[model samples]
Target chain A: MQQIKKDFPIFKRTINGKPLVYLDNASTTQKPIVMLKVLENFYFTSNANIHRGIYTLSEEATDKYEAVRKKAAKFIGARTEEEIIFTKNTTEAINCVRVSWGEKNIKKGDEIVVSSLEHHANLVPWQELAKSKQAALKIIPLTNDYTLDAEAYKKLLSPKTKLVCLTVESNVTGTIVPVKQMTALAHAVGAKVMIDGAQSVGHIPTDVHNLNCDFFAFSAHKMLGPTGVGVLYVKQSLMEEMAPFMYGGEMVESVKATSATYRSGPWKFEAGTPNIAGVIAFGAAIDYLSNIGFKKIMAHEQELLAYAKKMLAKYPQVKIFSPSQKHAGGIISFAISGVHPHDIATIFNNEGIAIRSGLHCAEPLMNYLGVYGTARMSFYIYNTKKDIDTAEKALKKVLKTFKL
Target chain B: MDIYTETILDHYQHPHHTGALNDATVSATEHNPLCGDVIKLDLKIKNNVVEKIGFVGNGCAISQASISLLCDAVEGKKISSLKKLKPKDIYDLLGVTISPGRIKCALLGLSALQKALKLTKN
Candidate 1:
């Protein structure tokens, strides 16, 4: 992990002349040298637009760009490359599903179920869809221990349940949901399932086929890749059932003034000239993570999270929201009984420790948990136990300053 | 920890005037919805001078302390000069450099103060 930390230049710098202790990996993971080098290499060597030219450079660029779709497909265990649609980010990818699937299938009286723990990217779009189509947007509540309540989800399911949008892992509480069990229930009621993988893909091992989810959405930026590139996986069986979110040059096969024939498979979803370099480099990011292996990464993160948990236990005023270390991912959302999250975060920042404070884009979850906000510390592949120790030490200083 | 000095924490722990005034002439409120920090300002003005000031809120120590300081800053000052207050003044009053992320938290009180002054002026 020390060698891995060296690959990210951000760790080399000092914050306020103190060594930077970064624990905000859930917001966005810092890119490694390998990812950045490939990104630069693409712009320098193959800068041509994909699928637009017969020239050598364009051919090479298109091959590299499309190759990422293949890499992404295999990375997530999708049946084919045709199932992967590259978009701007996870938000855009989820919006693509809402635009293409929700607009077409959801109708008045139909119910779209979302879990208690969706990020706004997965929640708000469904709300808008329900508002537009007059569909019912239902929610699965969380248990007291932060796990998704299975009984509430069963009660929400009916023949009218058209879709169930869920997060594979919550960004705020770091609760790794049992998507397989929930998907089975949703399928019993003939509802399609979409998994939000923004906080899950890089942190946990995932297999789309084994999970049997109808769709999955994730971003490269959160998984050690460059920004502006994300992937949406549509089940091959559902491909013809949905329409494209946008229409432009690359998506259509042949067009007249009034009507056009669209391309089959994932290409139909992509409209514009894509982020060529970012997509190609995304393949490199997947390669980087795959080579390191998720087992190794998850083990390291669990150790860091356990160390954080132990450190936080020393402060009796602290109330942690995430359940147990085994049931959770590598995040810990907590509040020091009297001190607000913003102040804790500020104090942590002053000590050169970087953590996130706020509702973390899950305001509904914050309301559900009966908290204004919680200070969050998330770990990643590059994070070490020392970072957690520094964070804990800084938190003690924060407690002293607040007199809590 | 440049932002949370002893003076600020002192104000945070023992905040100076809190609660709404029943006889107040003007009042206003603002909140940082992202973190749920809220500040409400009530001002009692007599003859174009601020006779009394109070803030009611719950938030981070920075916001609570800053509002507590603002409570003392507005009293006995001419109402005309109150509207001219800026974030720089608050920073000067607190004697600490605020980072960009917590600027909203620090200025939430001043934001309500400016809004209350608008009503008090009329």
Candidate 2:
């Protein structure tokens, strides 16, 4: 873990005269030196328009860029590289599915099921799709314990259910959903499933085949890769059936005056010049994570989450919104009894501890939980027990500063 | 810590004029949707002048203290004059430097006050 910490140079930074204790992994993880180097090196040597130029540098750039699709496919256990589509981020990837598949499949009176735990990225797009198509948008409510109510979800499915969108892990509550079982349930009702992997892919083992989801969307920035690059894994058959999300240069096969033929596979969905350096660096990030392996990553995160939970339990004023340890992930969302989340986050920031305090882009979940927002602390491979200890001291300072 | 000084903490801990005005002429509420900090202001006006000012709200120290100080600054002042108050005035009243991120928290009270002033009849 110390070696992993060293891989991220941001740890060397001092905030407010104190060592940084960053716990905002769910928002975005710090980039590692290896991934950063790959990003810089690509621009240095292989800066060229891919798939357009016939020169050697362009060919080399195209090869390196395309190779990441294969790496990403293997990283997530997809069937083939053709199943992966590069987009801006998780939101764009989900929008790609909505525009390409959802807009076509969902009809009037059709049902689109979403869980209570979904981030706005997954929820809003489906809401708009359902609204535009005059379809029914049903939600699977959360239980008293903050986990999605499985019984309610099963009852929500019907013959008209066209799609079920759920997150692999909640960015707000950090509840690791049983997506595989839920996917199977959606499949039983003849509905395709799209798993939002923004929070899960980086922290846990994610296999599209094992989960059996039709689509999976995640951001590179949240997984130790650079920003502006994300992956959308579409099942092979579904990818063939779906339309191209955007159409322009590189996606077209032949341009007639009136109509143009489109390229096959993921390239069709990627319309213009993609994030070449970010994608190539994302490949290096995949390699970096693969070298460390998920077993170690998950263990370290779970340990940190458990220790933080233990530390938070000592504060009676603090209320935990995440599920119990068995179902929780590497994130913890909580609020003090009298202190607002913003105040808590400010005090934490003063102490050089970075934790997110807001609705976390999950306002619907916050509304359901009956809180304006909760302060969140998310762990990753680089986080240590010492970081959690510093966060605890900051938490105590918040209580003191508020005179609670 | 710099933003939360002794004066701000005093106002936060012992807020002034924090009750709903039953005989109010106008009232308005403003909130920072992201932070969930809300400020509701009630005012009683006489001859285009503010006779009394009160408020009730829930939020962080900065927001609550800002509104507390705002109540004291606006009471007995002319409604037309109160509308001229700027965000800088609120920062000056707080007597602390408000960062860009906390600007909304610091100005929420002023926004509500101005909104109430707009609702006041001439």
Q: State which candidate has the highest lDDT.
A: 2
| DockQ of every predicted complex | 0.80, 0.70
Off by over 4 Å in 2: B119-122
lDDT digits (tens) for residues A246-356 of candidate 2: 989999999999999999999999999999999999999999999999999888888988899899999899998879888989999999877779888998998899999
First chain TM-score, candidate 2: 0.99
Q: For residue A235, what is the lDDT in candidate 1?
A: 93
Model 1 misplaced regions, further than 4 Å: B45-47, B119-121
Alpha carbon deviation, residue A225, candidate 1 (Å) = 0.5
- Among all windows of 10 consecutive residues in model 2 chain A, the one with the lowest summed lDDT is A395-404
Q: Candidate 2 DockQ category? A: medium
Best by DockQ: 1
Estimated TM-score for each candidate: 0.96, 0.97
Write one digit per residue (lDDT tens) for candidate 1, span B2-112. Answer: 777889888988899888888788889999977888788888889998888887888988889889998898899997788889999998888888878779988999899
